[model samples]
Target: MSLVFATSNKNKFEEARKIAEGHDLELEHRDVPYVEIQADDVVDVVKPSAQQATELLDSPCFVEDAGLFIEVLNGFPGPYSAYVYKTLQNRGILRLMEGKENRRAEFVSAVGYCEPGYEPRIFKGKVRGTITKESRGSGGFGFDPIFMPDLGEGGTFAEMSTEMKDALSHRGESIEKLVKWYVRNNRADGDRNESDS
Candidate 1:
């Protein structure tokens, strides 16, 4: 069986698809138009969105929301990262950090899954990093070109290949959690169905 991943972003869907494939799960992308709520954390933003998506599709589905939090800026774009990226973009962020010494930042991703008549389940992941002085590569979307993750070899997220980025990405971590949980639960459900038959 395939699980639906409701998102408008092809890039995000592709990234999550790759992770799901590694665990033998099929992910179907449904570009559902669901409203995201403004909240303190990405988790809060995704939970309702997932519930909305499940209602819209009349099936179990998942949605992911991510944010970029700059330590120096006091998480200026934590839950508002999408609007911030649309309005300010990466250049505006660099300009704000022009004279700052502390380039520390963090990227957080929350994947919320929901089935009909059930509350959404949340899986979260975060990665700490520093903002680059200038935009780097063209591999990733959003603030990727400007964020240098602390886990990798000094390269920004956009500088690395998709495989490399997935290995170190916050989205990857959260999606992995969702996939593992889905796999276990799905198998048990299949067994129950077979027993009933």
Candidate 2:
């Protein structure tokens, strides 16, 4: 069974597709736009989106929500990371971090899956790190260049290759959980074709 990943981000979908491939699962991308609720937690934001996507597409699907939480700012853009990225961008965030002694932060990802008429199942992943003084590499997207995971060998996410970043990323961890579950529960009954919706 091929499950659809409902998201409008081609970058995110491509990253997820790579991860799913490693687990012998096929993931289809559906650019199913849904309303993201204003919630303090990524999981809360994802659940309704997942349900809404599944309903709209009439298929089993999952939605992911991620955020960058800066300790000094007390999670300034915690649940509004996308909006912040749009309005502030990395430079704006750096401006906010100026003269700050504390650089601690974390990236959190939540994946919510739902089937028709069922409650969404949520999986979460987090990577603690420090915000970079300035953007680093040119890879990845959004805040990747500005966030350095503690486990990423001191390199900002954009500084690493996709495989390297995925190994230590919040989204990678969350998607891994979802893929594992699919391997155990959906593989036996799934189709092997890969396609977009």
Candidate 3:
């Protein structure tokens, strides 16, 4: 009932562990960095990362890549969100949005899962919203302070509680799809054990 999550981000590890716990699965962390390949799409990057990590660990494992795509910018940082976040930060995004009414954007996440002898499977999730004029709240990380989800109550992701954000966030949606796929494919360790018994 254990699946290795290929990531070193503590925040990601915590989120993934919470999701796995909800599904009654033991999620183990493999603290290794996979070389991120430059790709046109996040799936392309995540699939290879998952495959590489699984090979290194010789076990079932998963990796995720996410990005912030601004409609106004024609997805300038779609596959380079990490770099953008590190370099520009929320203030930079707000600067980009200043005097621009078309603040439409979305956050996309791709989760790639790989088993020892199986082809990788990808699950995608997205949240649509607009960039706030200024950063709000002190919760969440990265662009959360400026990225406002359409489902939220007039505030940025950083303003929402973890429970509230998870209930309506892009990453949550991706994890839900991942859990569904695992259950459907009998890849969930608990389900596999139950079937074996």
lDDT of each: 0.89, 0.88, 0.80
lDDT of 1 by residue, 3-122 (tens): 999999999999999999998998999999898889998887887899999999999999999999999999988989989999999999999999999999999999888888777888
Rank all candidate structures by their lDDT, best first, as comma-separated numbers. Answer: 1, 2, 3
**Candidate 1 segments whose C-alpha is farther than 4 A from its true place:** 187-197
Residue 52's lDDT in candidate 2? 95
Residue-pair clash count for candidate 1: 0
The local distance difference test score of model 2 is 0.88
Consecutive 10-residue window with the lowest summed lDDT within model 1: 188-197
Q: Candidate 1 vs. truth: CA RMSD?
A: 4.9
Once fitted onto the true fold, the runs of candidate 3 whose alpha carbons sit more than 4 angstroms away are 188-197
The alpha-carbon lDDT assigned to residue 169 of candidate 3 equals 78
Better of 1 and 2 by lDDT: 1
Determine which window of 10 residues in candidate 2 has minimal summed lDDT.
188-197
Instruction: Show model 2 residue runs off by greater than 4 Å.
Output: 187-197
Clashing pairs in 3: none
If scored against the real structure, what TM-score would every candidate get? Answer: 0.94, 0.93, 0.90
